[model samples]
Target: MLGIAAAVLFFIAFLINAADIATNDTFTSTNVMLIGLTVLALHVSGVGTGWGSRGRRR
Candidate 1:
């Protein structure tokens, strides 16, 4: 529940940042992609994001 909400929030913010960057012609950065990749990494690793942890004894 909490991880999904955090992911959703990150996604929404990423979209807004992308849109904001699209409106500007002088933009020369990969901030949006970095944000997206960060999200992906978090989702994949499931490390401390409320997602399932690997190698747990429980």
Candidate 2:
């Protein structure tokens, strides 16, 4: 559940950034690349890779 929440937050951040880019039309390539990388990293590390072990008892 924590991972899911983190993933959702990450996605919301990405959406906001995308909206900013769409409205301003002045966002740089570096900014876009960085945001993409951040989203990918968060998805893979926060949700995709760590999904299965999140709710188990030790």
**Candidates' C-alpha lDDT:** 0.56, 0.57
Lowest summed lDDT over 10 consecutive residues: which window, candidate 2?
A: 21-30
Which candidate gets the maximum lDDT versus the true structure?
Answer: 2
Among all windows of 10 consecutive residues in model 1, the one with the lowest summed lDDT is 23-32
Summarize candidate 2's per-residue lDDT along 1-58 as a digit string, tens digits. 4445555555655775666644344445445455656666666666556457558779
lDDT of 2 at 21: 47
